[model samples]
Target: FASGVDFHSATAVDMFPHVRAAVDSGEVLLEWDGKNGTPPKPLVKDKYASERRKAKTLNFSIVYGKTVQGLSKDWGVSLGEAQELLDKWYSARPEVLEWQ
Candidate 1:
């Protein structure tokens, strides 16, 4: 299950090379650590790594038609937090946002 999430997350990033490059270059900071090479360190560290993970999950959930209330309950966050995460995702991925 964990690996599946990681794969999905990695694949999601792969679909957006520009976004991944931004993350790698420190121009953007998403939940997961950006893989550099032999030594793997998060491109940008955050105290709320878990929260960020949840945010990423919520992003996928939204794409799958999950509702704000469902995401809040599933991720154990407030409705506002779930909404904020979605908002941040769309803001960062303007191409996807525009497509939607």
Candidate 2:
């Protein structure tokens, strides 16, 4: 949604007090548990690390109108790999791809 869509929105000040009162009730727990879940393993370091980050960057940039050649040069990937990455990104986020 765009920020412009909220232009017509309004709220009653009278509702704010009740909302604040509900928030003060211990109904919400605002702290995280101390357990630390295992973090994701870092992507393997290889000749492909730069290639892969480049590929993803190309996909991200192209979605916003960057040309294939410019994205390839900026991200240092070949055009074919950039195209493949764009395919993968769209496959992963079909809704977003549809929006594009």
Candidate 3:
């Protein structure tokens, strides 16, 4: 199905939508009962804020024309690492790098 596109979105052109496995698929905080007759409540959560925040910073940095040096400084990583990360990203999405 062709979902409605968000043309007004800032990262609409940069990011591709993806579906991942549910975070709380197996991990559950079940209420204990005296008897084992209680039905299990399916825990449902799929948020990973910290990792998402890190990725968001890197992504937006690239979108705003950040260089490998700037990325290295922002992430406190080695310059080589920063360059490698940028290289990996550009390799994965060649069209984006080509567009820029």
RMSD of each: 8.2, 17.6, 10.7
lDDT of 2 by residue, 31-72 (tens): 223366532332111212444344444445756887657756
TM-score of 3: 0.53
Q: Using lDDT as the measure, name the better of candidate 1 and candidate 2.
A: 1
What's the distance in Å from true for residue 10, model 3?
A: 16
- In model 1, which runs have C-alpha deviations exceeding 4 angstroms? 1-37, 40-56
Cα lDDT of model 3 by residue, 10-99, tens digit: 122222232123322433321234277643642221133333455557667788999999999988999999998787657645778777
Give lDDT tens digits, candidate 1, residues 1-100: 3443443344345435554675677664445433554324343224234444544665678678787788778878899987865665666556765666
Using lDDT, give the best candidate's number.
1
Candidate 2 structure, TM-score to reference: 0.39
lDDT of each: 0.56, 0.42, 0.51
- The number of clashing residue pairs in model 2 is 0
